[model samples]
Target: MNIRTMPVVAVLAFAASCSAFAADSIKIGVSGPYTGGSSPMGASMRDGVRLAAAEINAKGGILGRKIELVERDDQAQNDRGVQVAQELINKEHVVATVGYINTGVSLASQRFYEEARIPVINNVSTGSLVTKQFLPPEFPDNYIFRNAANDTIQSAMIVREAIDVNKYTKVAILADSTNYGQLGREDLEKALAAKNIKPVAVEKFNVKDVDMTAQLLKAKEAGAQAILTYAIGPELAQIANGMEKLGWKVPMIGSWTLSMANFIDNAGKNGEGARMPQTFIQEPNTPKRKAFIAAYQQAYNPPNGRIPSPVSAAQGYDSMYILAAAIKQAGDTDGVKIRQALENLQEKVDGVVTTYDHPYTHDDHEAITMNMVVMGQVKDGHVVYANAADKANAVREKASGKAKK
Candidate 1:
């Protein structure tokens, strides 16, 4: 109950006095950075998972077994993620694990799950290669699945908004030095290359670094029309704040991390007009979304009534339901059976993000795609639909959850 420095959570404590129920409970691992700069995304993701697990447990649970979440705070560090992965797999003996907010941590830690055939659904991490690490032919059997939109989809959308919509000819790339940033930067470059455009300036900075004057000045000198970013919340705020200091104002287009509360709150009005691709916004465009928003608001009572990272929370919520459906379909908690069931889900999971119907396949592990993503712009204080049409058509699109393009 005491929310301390790292916010360690042992969610979903069921009736422990009942020895039979305790033995019948299903153990699942939830790993992410519950503290530090990345906590906005990580904590939001874990909370969403908690909501889903509580709902499932209340409804006679999955396969009549209560869902027990074994939580771990990875602290947004790669080495810590590796250690957590091992503990979750070995000591905790989790059937499946969910939540990986950082790409570097996902890459470093997911291998242990792969080795154990334990399903690890990356609820937040969007590195292009996160799901491709254990593809067929190379590894025969793969254990990774992702519900979040990958960098390939996000980078392409970022370029489309930058080049096609805004018609910006000269842009600058500023990405963090972490695996998430560098890999996303590469994806952005590839996306730009497809349009035969190269950035005027490409700069890199480390996480928690406040000063971005050097990077912004270089982009300013190059007459860059906009700044393309691939980084997390806190540092991203610095870019906007730094630009204000140099009196250089330009459109900030970047990955979904631009929507994080840390960036939006820290950058203040400076963060306004920033655009990024998002799978789920805070808006309740559908019935499921309305209920989710209301439930999350009532349970967490987050500041300003906004989930810290709405996309992360929504995707995390959907991932839990999807995984639960797989467990039920598999008729057992065996890791291999759950993995097989996930590859071919029989039921339609009515999730906050989308109505997932057989969302994954043996050949493809990614559940969300580019068509499900829409450009969200920071206006006033929160993210709003960049185009009203996207919101108007949300119900029909989400109902089917099919790829249009």
Candidate 2:
């Protein structure tokens, strides 16, 4: 062969080899903040995703191809998350993604996936707007789906817990400045409005703000019988500590972030009795949950053999299984096909959180709803059902829901 022709043939051969290697494994992007303040949730979620992938790959893999996770730590920053999203889509060519611990990060990064038609299963981000960013009037297809409880449901639960259950007429709203916190605060307001109650004071604090004296003082002055929060673990813990300093002990009812290990550990006894919505507690009430807890404990060996963030870990594990089920049903790794399969999953996916069956639709993308969520309280360094009544109510609600057989 001619020398120039030989170089061209060699390049072609290398290209073919690259294509074959790519086809041998399915790349799924795992993007989350593996460090910084949100690391408890992010790291636990990532470990859960890893565990699910390992389990699937062990069972002859999905559709005869090994699952490859391309993990990128967004560091809980929106800009960094955008960069990771672009890299995962344009460079790594991941068919799907399954991690977003931060709402701002998910909102900023998921647009790229929507544009590229890549499916993103948000396992941890609870911003109400995260899944609804792309709609029919503006866009024909939405590539984003969520397995965690959205703030809408969580806010309603919080409101009910405070006003209806605890009978707190005066409440104050405390939220962080980020998109997650702010949006959750708004949801809380709307939920309160629906109940014909207004917050005594609405306060905002930036992330990493150790001193919540001003916020708590305002709430105290306003005679807030309850302090409703919509922030992450670290900041929430600060609020509990600040309240302790101010000698103000009010019922802390808020979003699901209260269940995070960072908050529990940082706030210590001050964080006790903080109620929040939880999709899954660490307790193994079911066979699936027991197995998942054991697997996660053996895999990560977290403190006291408890998962750091049980809700995040369980949601992450279930998100991976749901995505894998979709891929298997689709019988291919194409993003559009995967999205369609996710929207129309025929088989029931028994997840650690709940058994998912047709969890999505063309218009609605939220998989977990209010029915699956239960009120949990921090007790003795762990989150558990606040009472037997709440647990019984949650079980009855789940039994009455449309969970597929």
Candidate 2 C-alpha lDDT tens digits along 1-405: 211122323323422343344567888899999999999999999878877776776566699987778889999999999999999999998999999999999999999999999999999999999999999888999999999999999999999999999898999999999999899999999999999999999999999999999989999999999999999899999999999999889979988989988999999999999999999888877777777787777656788987889988888888999999999999998889999999898988878887787888887788887767888999999999987765654432232244422
Pairs in clash, predicted candidate 2:
none
Stretches of model 1 off by over 4 angstroms after superposition: 1-21, 395-403
The TM-score, computed over Cα atoms with residue i paired to residue i, of candidate 1 is 0.94
**Relative to the unseen true structure, what is the C-alpha lDDT of residue 87 in candidate 1, on a scale of 0 to 100?**
97
Give the Cα lDDT of each candidate. 0.89, 0.86
Q: Cα lDDT for residue 200, model 1?
A: 98
In order, how many clashes per candidate? 0, 0
Candidate 2 error regions (>4 Å): 1-23, 389-405
